[model samples]
Target chain A: MLEALRKISDVVWELPVTHKAGMRVPARIYGTEKLLQEMDEAVFDQISNVATLPGLVKHAICMPDGHFGYGFPIGGVAAMDTEEGVISPGGIGFDINCGMRLLTTNLTAGEVEPYLKSLVDLLFGRVPAGVGSRGSLSLSRTEFRRVLEEGAHWCIENELGRPEDLARTEEHGRIAGADPSLVSEKAIDRGIHQVGTLGSGNHYLEIQAARPADVYDPELARAFGITLPNQVVIMFHCGSRGFGYQVASDYLKVFLKVMEASYGIKILDRELASAPFRSPEGQDYFAAMKCAMNMSFANRQVILHRIREVFADVLGRSAEDLEMHMVYDVAHNTAKLERHLVDGTPRELLVHRKGATRAFGPGAEDLPAAYRETGQPVIIGGSMETGSYLLAGVSSGDQAFFSTAHGSGRTMSRTKARRTWRGRELWREMEERGIYVRTASWAGLAEEAGAAYKDIDEVVEATEMAGISKRVVRFTPLGNIKG
Target chain B: MPYEFLEDVATADIAFEAWGSDLEEAFSAASEATLNVMVEEPGAVRPLETREIHLEAEAVDVLLLDLLQELVYYKDAEQLMLRVDDLEVTGGPPFRLDALARGEHLDPERHRPRVDVKAVTLHRFRVEKTDRGWRASVILDI
Candidate 1:
């Protein structure tokens, strides 16, 4: 598979259309030589399969963190002409709008270190987590529908979020065109109480410190709100939880029935099931997807509220006095309509980014005023045992339609990781390294060992060399609460 | 043991293969495998409740998928750690599965939690008959 790729650059490779049949475009992959070599071969199969989808422009893309996934390989990205292409649930993923949110606090690592354990424990107890855990808020069907329509705004109206936080969120935390009627009763029933939950399986909230030495770009770091050395910031990774999962599952069954029968679209993989964008099935899924998107925003906003309260309580200060302001929120699993220059012509393309971040460059429209000159912040969370990064999209990012890697991609499977690292030992090791940890399950803790994932620094470096997103600051873990 | 997790099939998720002499046994094996993915100790979930599942799919392979998905749905919607007590699979134009699943509401302390199984994926999903028995392969998104 590696030999079949054309070396386009030091950090880029292309799988030509001739590599496989039914491909409308070639496949563009971003990775360092080592990263490409380490990539699982299934990514080649999946990305090529993605290239075959109708109306795909430029090329199907695999980010540096690419790995084997069901339909579209995780870290896959593709831009399709809305009028001519198709919409796929696989491309957006089961966890609709699974995203990352970062917040800056006036407190420094030194100030928080002594109380890190209490903070993580309090958060672990407060935030719902693990298998089948419900949320902090209970809502009737009617109020949940409002959450679907209003998104984070509902949280703001309910006094869970600050008005200023909305602008910093992607799409202002509410995707337009959401029709609650398009959502199913099953999806609502599954996730109605999950609006504020941090679901298990790679979901977590962490306290980290952005040290002065790790600030790759001083100006960019300052602009993104990392003003103090060893600035203690909070970051969380989650999505719409079970509601989003059910939404994707429900639509997959619907698309499997109607994709070829109604729209005559035949996909190579059953997981690649899709429908024409204008078709009734496609329009309805898109509408419902937005609702899940809103549900996710509401979910994260509520979690953010909990984090603020916990920090304030542990620190004996009001959240406002601590200046726990949001830096940015970015969704990795999603499809958004954006105008991008294709072959020198501006066209609205529905860009599907699965496990890939939208790294729109500076001057990109819709960016908050503060970040307009700096570009949108991209939060790539590493494993709990490793440090994470803050990155800014660069102008050169448009080459891949402004998409970048999401995290340190998994290298070892869960069973293998569990076999190699004991959960109790891993926890002790992290403790020795000055990282406070709280988890719902020790078995899950073993599966997330740092060695189970590729090096985050290398992944971020590959994206930087590829000119998609640039490094701003690196934050080492001080505390972690894993689901 | 009727089922065993496949270590390398899924990197970010979990995959398993279950086997039995017939469709009913195979469905039960797959059900237990899916249950094991959610809880480290399946024996901890007492038979405090039961739910009846009826599903019809285009083929036997999809019926297996649907059965596995039903377990995940119960976990999410009802917080039930249901495992297959018994099931019957019927062959037809639309394959059918009828099962009685039994388990109790999740007790975090009693049932050691693992990752949540989001959905059953179509990637490499299959059901086949071998020389010895029926075999089903599933990859669960976590």
Candidate 2:
């Protein structure tokens, strides 16, 4: 892989446009030599394929946590000219708007340590998880459509979360232009009962604490609500569930049939199925995708409400007394219309981020007043055994289209991880280390062993060095509920 | 091989290929392999309730994908872990599949659920006829 890549800087590599004939732009990768070596060679192939797509501006890029994926590398970030460029469901991935949310509390680890086990059990019971786990609330067809259109705002309207949560979420927890008519009935059927549920494999809700020693930028950490060591927080990872999957699957078929036959477009991989962003088919897909994105926000919002209720029950205090306020929520997978400076002139581009986080710099008008001076809060999750990080978007991030690595990307396959460790044993080990864990499937836990993923510290270091995003605080897990 | 898991097809997802003497046998084995990924055993599912599935796609590989996704829909929407009871495939530029599946609503004690396959991705998806009869390969996003 190194033989085909040209080192552009200490932490950047480039794949020349000459590598592929139809390529419209070069491909750039951010990583250290060691981290680059750890990446699968297929990532280069996938990213290069992405570069060949129509109207791709600047370059096809990948973050330090880059890994092999179907059409686009998991950590890929690309921007396309709205008029000529295309939109691909594979680029956004199956789990539309799969993202992370962090909630800050006044409580500390010491104050909650004694009840950590019970907290874990309570949270595990409250948040529906595992395969086929239906959410506590069942939505009728009409109510479900409202969720698709309203996003987290639906949760707020239903009294699941405070209005403040909407302020801190990406796109204010709701993206406009969702058309329920564009979404298929099968997609709605799959999503109706799955709201507020955590789907299996790599999805989790964790209780974490930030130690003083783990603080990276003290002032920034404080601004983001991290006050002192062991400050308690709750974080969860999930997506649109089966609704998003069906939407992507349903559209890939449309793009595959229309791209070549109607638009005369050609692609190297079928998984990269796409349509011009301005075409009728593309607009229809974008509309349907917004519905899935909104549904996901609503799903996480409902889960947040559940967490608050569980805490109140276990701690014997009102949620207000606990001060369980949301810090921020960010999506890792999405395609959005944004205006960015290209060659010193602003251009409207559809930015696609797959396994990448949007890290808009400070003073961006879209940010709430509290974050306007501090920049968007980027929540990066790690494995259950490893610690996670809270980073703030930096002005320097415009170099990579304002995107950064989403998480510690997987390094090993599920089969390999399961073969190396037993889930039952790992659960016991985590418990011994003071991290309580409740899982629906033990074998599923083995598939997510920390060893299966790239080291978070190294990935974050490379991200910072590449001028994408800067760290604010580091958080270690206290207890977790894994699906 | 009747059916076997494939390593290295994807980084985090699972992939497998199923073979058969005919298309029906191959499709049945593929469906079984997918269910087996979620539960300890596919044989453990009794034929208590039966659900019918019909799929139409532009290509043969897509026919397989639609079929798998149908089964996944049942698992997520209805909480049913099904085993393919019967299957049939026929026709042209537009391919079609008719299948019957049997299973029961998941019971944690009995199913010992392993993982939920979120979707059948087009990554490395293929369907081909070999000297041994027929084969299909799929990579599932979990």
Candidate 3:
């Protein structure tokens, strides 16, 4: 597989269409030569498989953080013809709309450091975590349906967040065309008590600070509502919990039967089962997927509310005094319709981004008024021990269809990490480094050891050097709540 | 032996192979292995209650996937970390699975949890009747 790749540039490699038979388009991978050499052979196989899917436009692209996932590479971005393309659930992943949200606080790390342990404790107690963890809110069948249809608006209407927050969120915190009737009863039951909860394995709520040394572009940082050194912030990473999982599970079966058995479309991997975008099965999954997308938006919104309450309780300060405002929220795993110039012609394409973030450049019509000049905020989270990053979209990103790497992709497997490190020891080590940590299961924490992932700094650098994204600021972890 | 975990399969997920004298036992062992991934002790889960499951699929492999997915649904929705107390399978053009699951809600004090098994993946999923017995291999998205 490595021998088959042709070097296009310092940070790009091409797998020609002739590399594999039946490939509709070529596969292009973005990464440093060192990164490419270390990549698993399975990534080549997976990306090649994705290129074979019908109606793919231009090329099948993998971001710098790419890794071998079930059907598609984790950081893969593929655009298909809206009128004749296919929609595969595997292309979107099991955790629908799994993404990140950043909240900027007026308080400094010095002010919060005194109460960091207490704040983390309060957050851990307030926000449920781990498998089968239940939240404070319980919805009936009817109310749950509303949550599916309305998304974050339901949370705002219930007074969980301010109306202004909608402006800072991707898709205005709600994805329309969510058909609640299409969601399975089992999915509803799983989602009823899981909202506002953070599930295990990589989901986290971390408190961080930005020092002047970490700021790459001061003007852009200030424009993003990030101020001087020591400014504190909170980041929440989660998704639609069990609701989205069941939705994907249910639809995958339907697609397998319909696309394969009925439509007679053969796929190399069963996990890549899909239906045409205009087909009944595809449209139904799209509508149902919107419900999961909205559900995730609402889930993160509720967690934000809980964080605010904890800050107030721990600091004995009013919400107004704290001035904790949402910076931005972005979804990584989703398929959305967007217009991009394809060969100098504006065409509507269905873009599927799995384990990748939308990094639309400045002046993109979808951006908020404040960000119209600077571009969208791209949040890239790192390990608990390592640092995170804040970036902005660059016009050059349009070349890759306006998508970028999601995070410090894992280098080691969960099993290997668990075998190499003890979670209890890792927790103690973090505390010794002045980084507070709280978790439900120690083994779960072991699976996310910092050593398990590539250096976030390097991954972010590769993306910037590749002209896919630009660095705005860096965040050093102060404390965290791991699920 | 009914089942044994296969450790060196995939980096992001877990996989196990199960065997039985016939199809029913292999499916039952597969359920046990799935439960063992979540809890420290599979037998520690007392069969305090039982919930019945009835499913129909076109093939045996899809039937196994459906049965395992049903267990995951019950775990997340009802908080029941179930073990297959009884299972019956009838293979035909329309394969069928009727299962009786038994367990209690997950209690942090009693049950030591591991990685949460999100869903069963079709990524290298298989089921076959060997010369000696029926065998199945499945990979789970955790």
Candidate 4:
């Protein structure tokens, strides 16, 4: 697989269409030479498989953080012609709209350091975590229907958040066209008690600080709402929980049953089960998918409410007094309709980004007025021991349909990480380095050891070099609540 | 051990292979491995409740996938952590399986929550008859 890659540039490699049979287009990979050499061989196979799917425009692209996933490689990007393309649940992960949210604070690390432990402890107690964790708000089947339609508006109207928060969120915290009638009873049952809960297996809420030294573009940093040196901030990663999973599971079976018979499409991987974009089954999944998307937006909005309450109570100050305003919220897993130039022709494409974040450049439509001049703020989370990054989109990002790397993708498998380190010991080591940590399970923490992931600096740098996104600021961990 | 977790099969998810003297035992072992991924101690879960399961699939592999998905569904809908107490498997164009699941709602105190498995994936999912008996390989999304 490595030998088959032809270097396109310093950071781009091409897997020619002739390399695989039935490939509609070639596969392109973005990464440094060193990063490419270390990539798993399975990544090549998976990306190549994605290239064979019908209605793909241009090439199948994999970002710097790429790794082999179930059907599509993680950090992958593909744009399909909406009028003639297909929609696959495998393209968008089971965790529909699993995304990241970041907020800026007027308070400095110095002010929060005194009570960091208290803040984290309170957050752990206030926001539910781990398997089968339930939140404070319990909704009925009927109320959940409203949540699927209104998204974050439901939370704000319920007094869980401020209205301005919607402005900083993608799609304004709500994805429309959700046919609640299409959502199943099983999915609603799973969603009823799971809102506002931080689920396990890589989901986390961490308190971090940005020092002036870590700011790469000071001008862009301030534009994105980082005003002071040693400033404190909040960033959390989660998804729609079980409601989204059930939706994807339900559709996977539906597509499998009809894909070969009704659509006459054959896939290399069964997980890649898909239906034509205009097919009855496909449109039904889209409407049902919007429900899960809105549910996740509401889920994160409620979690934000819990965080604000904990900070205010712990610091003996009003949330307003602390100036905890949101920076941006970006979804890494989703399929959306967008207009992009394909071979010099403007076309509407259904972009599927799994483990990839949309990094639309400055002046792109749908961006809030405040971000029109600075492009979209992209949040890239690192492992607990390592730091996370903030980047912004550039016009050059159009090379890959305005998509960028999602995170510091894992290098070692969970089994290897568990065999190498004890979670209890890793917790002690992080504390020694000034990162206060709290988690529901120690064994689970071991699986996310910093050493288990690729170097975040290298991953972020490769994206910038590829001109997909540019770095703005780096954040160091101060405290964490691992679900 | 009837089952063992495998490395290199999946990078970001969990994968395991299980075996037994026959098809029923192979399915049972796969259930235990799946439970172990969510809880630190399987034995700690006492049989505080029982739920009946009846499913029919066109193939053996689909049968195993559907059965495992039932466990994931109950975890979210009712917060239950169920274990297969006993099961009966019959082969045909439409394979049939009936089982009694016994466990309790997830109690963080006893179950010792590890990772919440979101769903089971068809990526490399398989069931095969071996010289000794049967084996099943499964991958889970987290």
Residue-level lDDT tens digits of model 1 in B47-99: 98989999998899988888888888889889999889668877786887888
What's model 3's overall lDDT?
0.88
Chain A: TM-score in each candidate? 0.99, 0.99, 0.99, 0.99
Candidate 1 vs candidate 2: the lDDT winner is: 1
Please compute DockQ, using alpha carbons, for every candidate against the native two-chain complex.
0.83, 0.78, 0.60, 0.84
**A44-143 in candidate 2: lDDT tens per residue?**
9999999999989999999999998778989999899999899999789889999999998889999999889899998998898898788988789999
* Cα lDDT of model 3 by residue, A168-243, tens digit: 9999999878999888888898888998998887889999999889999999999998996889999978988999
- Candidate 1: give the clashing pairs: none
What lDDT would candidate 1 get against the real structure?
Answer: 0.92
Cα DockQ of the candidate 1 complex = 0.83
Which pairs clash in the backbone of model 3?
none
Consecutive 10-residue window with the lowest summed lDDT within model 1 chain A? A415-424
Fill in the DockQ of model 4: 0.84
lDDT for residue A307 in candidate 3, whole number 0-100? 94
Candidate 4's residue-wise lDDT over A1-483, tens digit each? Answer: 778999999999999999989899999999998888767887888899999898999999998998878778888899999977899888888999999999988989998999999999999999898887899998988899999999999999999999999999999999989888987898888888998999988899999999889999999999998989999999999999999999999999999999999889989999889999999999999999989999999999999999999999999898888888889989998999899987788889999999999999999988999999999999999998899999999999999999999998888887778889998999999999999999988878998899888889999999999999999999999999998
| Pairs with backbone N, CA or C atoms under 3 Å apart (clashes), candidate 2 | none
User: Which candidate ranks first by lDDT, i.e. highest?
Assistant: 1
Tell me candidate 3's TM-score on chain B: 0.95
